[model samples]
Target: MKKLFIAALLFVGMVSFAQDAAQPVKQQRERLTPEQRNEKHLKKLTTELNLDTNQQAQVAKLLADRSAKAQKHMEMRKARKDSSIKPTAEEKAALKKEIMDEKTATEAQMKSILNAEQYKKWTAMRDENKEKMKDKMKERKNKL
Candidate 1:
């Protein structure tokens, strides 16, 4: 009876460890970095849109530039959060305007990179991706 109890405990512990190990691997795969996402988007565009060399180069550069700007904006927001200081209403409005303006500029750049037909397709793909991401996030929240 004593030997059997020890064996059962060992088995339980091993099963617990195996379960814990698998979770982190699954979570890591789900958590994508901004750079990784940008690269994936570029690859998708190339494959789906059948971009030529010049178009690919232009799109790649546009994506990289937009990604860098977005990272900078995110860092600024993090810094603001870490400071434990709240902005005034006017300041908040100004910041919102700035972000919107930046988005407008980025959209213009995308327009310059893509022709009319490609832009329409690109916009559709972007909307579909946003919906897919929303669904994924909802599922993740329910799991938590």
Candidate 2:
């Protein structure tokens, strides 16, 4: 009985170590190229929306563009972080305005691409996701 227990523990430990060794650790926000990001978003949207091929192609282009723009913005933010100087009030306001304008433009493009029902469903999903993010942030804040 003692030998059996010891062997089982050894097997469990070995399996656990093998699993750990099989996984590659990555950075918290390890960078992916825009094309890679676009592919991921395309797969997600297709699964969610049941997009036709034409719609998928159009959405892919939009997603690629959005991903590139996002990467650019991320680079800018990183640059700002690395610098000692904080952005001016005007700069902050400008950044916010830019983000809002892009969001509106993207929505318009999406509406044009999607059928009426899909657009409505997409909006609902986006809002739900926003709410979930807010809740997550609140929970994180409470934890701190």
Candidate 3:
């Protein structure tokens, strides 16, 4: 009777091990093309902002351009990492300044494209996301 109970416990342990081993690993999301990304952004904005056809067209164009620029910037950054050349303080500052300029330009374009109410909502959303990102970074830093 003791031998039989020991055998049952061993069998249960093996079954649990097999079940755990069979579970699939979580996969990251597949990368999207710039145009597809822009389209996705447009859809989200349209849903949130209730954009009209003309506004949609303008926003689509702006999003596509923004996405393209962002993709290029990321590729450039990756290339810089591959080259093993570390940026100096001045270079880092310049890059940051350029990013800020681009952001300011984008915000201006958005304001021109959207009505006052829509722009206000969009800014609010942007601010909220920025805060969330800051919190996430702070948490990550604390973890480190």
Candidate 4:
């Protein structure tokens, strides 16, 4: 009787451990890198806005440009992270302004590719995705 009881307890414990292990795997699968997020947003926009081939090509170019700029900014920031070397407020502001300008340019180019109605839908989709990304990041931070 004791042997059977022990076996049952062990089986239950194993099942619970398996379930705990599975949860994080599921969560990790849902997590997106910056590139993945961009691709997903583009895909959603394309589907919802019914982009033509020309629009799709233009959007792709915009995405590539944005990604390159973002990567460069990240690299620059990483290079500036030495404890003894800090950016001045002016320098930081300048960098931020540059990034914002690049973003505005990209958005303008995208707008040119899309019709007014499509642009509106695209903007709405982009806003919704920004919120979703914020929520996902919050969830990841909570997990950490």
**Model number with the top lDDT:** 3
By summed lDDT, the worst window of 10 consecutive residues in model 4 runs over: 1-10
Predicted candidate 1 versus true structure: per-residue lDDT over 1-144, tens digit per residue: 112233344455456556675565322235467678778978999998878889888888877777777677667766888998888899989978987787678678878888888888888987897687567556645654
Instruction: List clashing residue pairs in candidate 3.
Output: none
TM-score for candidate 4, residues paired by index: 0.66
Cα lDDT tens digits for candidate 4, 4-99:
233344455446556675554322245566678668867876899998888887887777667676667656666787555799999988977886
Candidate 2 local Cα displacement, residue 62, angstroms: 0.8
Candidate 4: RMSD to truth: 14.0
The CA-based lDDT of model 2 is what?
0.74
True-structure Cα RMSD, model 1? 13.4
Q: Lowest lDDT 10-mer window, candidate 2? A: 1-10
User: CA lDDT of each candidate?
Assistant: 0.71, 0.74, 0.75, 0.69
Question: Which is the winner by lDDT between candidate 2 and candidate 3?
Answer: 3
**How well does each candidate superpose onto the true structure, as a TM-score?**
0.68, 0.74, 0.75, 0.66
Error of 3 at 133 (Å): 1.9
- Alpha-carbon runs more than 4 Å astray in model 1: 1-25, 30-36, 137-144
Cα displacement (Å) at residue 74, model 2: 1.3
lDDT of 2 by residue, 1-144 (tens): 112233344455445556675565533455566587678878988888889999999999888777677767767866897986799999999988988888898999999999998898889988997787567556645643
lDDT of 3: 0.75
